[model samples]
Target chain A: MPDRANDPTDALRRVDLVLRVHDHQIVGPEGELLGNVDDVELAEVDGRWLVTGLMVGPAALSQRLPGKLGTWTHAVWSRLHPDREPTPVVVPMEHVTDIGSAVALDEWAARRLARTLGLELWLREFVVSRIPGAKGGSSDERPGDLVESASSEATEAAEGGSESEAALRPRPDGRPVSGLLGRTGLSPDGERLGRLRDLWALGGPRDGHPEPLRVTHLEFTSHRLGAELGYSADDRQGPALVRAFFRWLHRNDRVVPISALTGIDDTGRTVTVETTHMRHPFDQ
Target chain B: MKKFFAIALGILTAIGGFVDIGDLVTNGLVGARFGLSLGWVVVLGVVGICVFAEMSGRVAAVSGRGTFDLIRERLGPRVGLTNLVASMAVTLLTFTAEIGGIALALQLATNVNPYLWIPVVGAAVWIVLWRVKFSVVENVFGLAGLALIVFAVALWQLGPDWSDLWRQASRPLVPHDESHTTYFYYAVALFGAAMTPYEVFFFSSGGVEEHWTAKDLGVMRANVFVGFPLGGILSFAIAGSAAVVFQSQGIQVDTLGQIGLPVGMAMGQLGLALVLLGFFAATFGAACETGLSVGYSISQYLGWQWGKYVEPLRAARFHTVLLLSTIVGVGTLLTTVDPIMLTEYSVVFSAVALPLTYFPILVVANDRTYMGRHANGRLANTLGTFYLVVVGVAAVAAIPLMIITRAGQ
Candidate 1:
């Protein structure tokens, strides 16, 4: 057993032996009640499961409850505050700035980080894209020629129309879409590459901004083993056999840099990237 | 005229597809034992289902994601997984009972052993899941299920005093002979039967499968609002018929055949035949629903590709789960476990599991992030909140009542 309490690193010390930080209180630099940790956001890098961020907000707290009670809490909250965007506020480790008695963060920096959560990217990329009649030339709508409407329609369709924007920003509910942990990844050529299993981010901000932590590398997997629990990412954590099984399952895991991403489809479901920019981070 | 026909078709099918084996058995049992005293629970359950189904259907139409998908997303892994496990367990159990119901309905027609029909029914359900179009499957069975309206017709044919049946239903109370615990126990069962989680699962997933858009919201709402309450009337009819035929003589309804006995007595062989046809279709439709729901909740949780809209080969894992669930259903029935008993237990368990499925949908329905302009209105919120409280109370009371009544002896 590892003695995390005696660990020199503050972040490492805050996390117990199990590394379970859920329900831990999150506070600002001056100890303001930002929220409690609803879930831990993780990313895969070099065969490791590193904590990427903490998900907070009422939505996050609702998720912390184990079972239908969580759902009811979320539902009641949603109904009572429909105008508030239901997305949980995510504070990436980059914006975490400091780790101490309260998982401290600069208030403004944390709010800024919340806007660019992987969850919101997921909502824009996957959920919003699948909205029926959301875009033209959809799977159902074959673009039979009305040549004039076709061009504008093509542009709108390529943009995933205005719906993607609506999804990125909350509409009636104040909830901003965040968290993109489980969205499927599609190549630039529309070949089904794999699911976006996890993201890789450098710890802390570089140049006074957390942009360096803006998903430096996206881990994609054709397998489902690490999609939920992220077991494949941390190859060394689980039992040897289980770890070996996940490694075998995710042997084909591909890591692509953010630079490779070209245009996300209008529906926001698929992220298109130039394969030329694909650098295998694992080989490093 | 064409639009009119389409709307009418939607409404007819909605009414027809409403009742399943749960409703049939619970209503029959309630009617025989409590004599319409528990009828109010059906009304409340139906309203709850309509409110949630409309919300879920709307969410699916607008967001193109099903209930379990949103549930997992909103609730995170642990809670979502627990909900998935609980909801799937009940759904799979319901699936088993539905398959058993189909076999029993077959036995009613052929006098053959129900056990023999289990494998055959399972295979047929799998085949339909494998080959049928989403719409065709829903339409065929949904329309066929309308044959249950024969129960209402049979009740009419019985010439019971309308005033007394009305009085019994209007006055909600425990019967003199039945304990309050037993009465409420069956009330929860009736509520569970009417608002089984799988119905919303099927409804929302079906909306996504059919690619419902904002334009189709009217059709979907019509199906839920008008059709479901009218279908609730069918549940009342089943209960009412039993109240007239069996309540006076104190005949307890325990078998699938006993559920149809009221119809058999009122309309003889032909009415019985029609009701059996209704039984076969209703259970088979729900069997398909519950089976697919098991796959839906699991696959949606894991973020795997799912639904019949995709080719079976494309969703191999989903198809695999469906196959395994069907096998389990068949195996359970092969143990000679009584399906009617399963149906009884299923409703009670469903009551316990109610809050799990219902809460997520209510949350997602109110989610402005997803619903946009289609989010629940004030009226919807009021009714939804009221039902949430009712559902919560039933959920809390279900287990104790079950134990106290010894699963409603």
Candidate 2:
């Protein structure tokens, strides 16, 4: 990449760093990457126009001007960079490969750019790789989140159910849902369990189990599990642990308990909802 | 017909829900100080957020990516990291204020000291974050926040001469009571309030959470295009009332109780109760949004496990951050710093961070590779470019203005 060490005084200069595949925006300087920038990496690597780091800054500008002048650049940038972690807003020149709206970069910027690569490589191998059931793929491999992170749908369903709680019904939301209202239950994580699914009343007297209940578990979409949901008789946590040995392995299905679900209440509350404790309903 | 009514209701609820700690504190302070002279700023801000939020929502729907998810694809790690850090700070500040605001609202209604309620309110927020369904928190709180319509009711009740109110709103200039320095400061504050970072964070993130695919783009756009401006209307209502009632009285709105005075004056007890309900819901809602934004950015950036969809123990780190931020916000309020003041600093600081986050968004949105056929259209690019300039100027001058006006003292 063009090693244009940005001068302290010359403010309008653009410096090139290498782009990695996994770059995304965060809420601030400290958060994780929010998304990736599909862009051209134009930098002079060695002597050729081997594109370097991709350009990602304010929609206002291509790259933020560096150093003090750039300091007066944006409120968010200033706050994130406030005299604390002044990690230069730069990636090295080695990681990038192509250029366009979506520029592909080397999988690991740390691997190519580090002057002291041996140590980082070793630690990545020894410490980082072996951090107790760590997913050891290059950061680029898992860049895109497959599903929604938060579920406003589930929250709204709960709220609506609560509002109509007086109607002793089954689950409020549609779909096959078991009632977890009045019965006490254990959490998947052993914490005090809350409500699970409120089956709604299809058409009955103002009474209990006569109503159909729709289940809306805690926000446990496939996205949360970071894997696909598939439960088999032989498929146990033991195999799941072994499956995790492969960095790319992800079992989408998570285990939810049948009993932890409290009885369905006419009030539309799904009590004894457990998120973390593990019991195999299939096994049960 | 019922579903349509619900959608319309959803849209209305979104309007009220859009104004959070950022809007409440920023607009209130500006109205008291700058009067209706800066009404234009809120308009501009509403338009700006609509443009971006629509793009983000569309992107989320079509691409199945959250706002931060898109940011990652468009910006590389280094620059993306920069965006993450900047966005998180602003979100956290707003989060702090939102929690504090919730406490303040409770205090207002109960007449109990706000400090005593801070911990309880904080815990309640955390509990909701922990177990409550995401939609329940959003739709319910969003609908409940419409209680703020009492501000408009109060304005009507105050019976500010329409001609006078119209003239004041129309003649957009620095008022005689405030110096130009303070005038610009409050103007920027008003703009900052309108475009406060958390709103976008919440909007885009909400898009992803709702499983919006490109097919849902129209719905997303409708929400963004319609939701935010309407929210801006609520903000203006509050500020205009203050401009009418408090300006003549020389009463600057430094307290939550006083912010509701217009409602009290116009609609008496019912209005006051509704306004307080609005306050509780808005602040409480915003606290949840801001708190989630913090976690969303952190997890999305690192490619770590994240999201409420996961069991708390499953996404340990993400939950840890969420839990930690709630504690910090409560702790920050416990220091006895004014919630209003915290919100003020948060808005001003968010203004400073605006360019950093929005700039990359504009660039990425315009790019063809990631967005492909979905790249920004001419209208988007033009508006995006214009806002970039506006944001650039604001970013450059925010600090100097803050220092000059002493945070609009």
Tell me the DockQ of each model, to 2 decimals: 0.03, 0.04
Give candidate 1 regions above 4 Å deviation. Answer: A1-284
Q: CA lDDT of each candidate?
A: 0.71, 0.58
Tens digit per residue, CA lDDT, model 1, A26-84: 54554333444555555544544355566655566565464677789788767654244
> Top DockQ: which candidate number?
2
What TM-score would you give candidate 1 relative to the actual structure? 0.63
* Residue B389 in model 2: lDDT: 80
| Segments of candidate 2 deviating more than 4 angstroms | A1-284, B1-6
TM-score of chain A of each: 0.48, 0.20
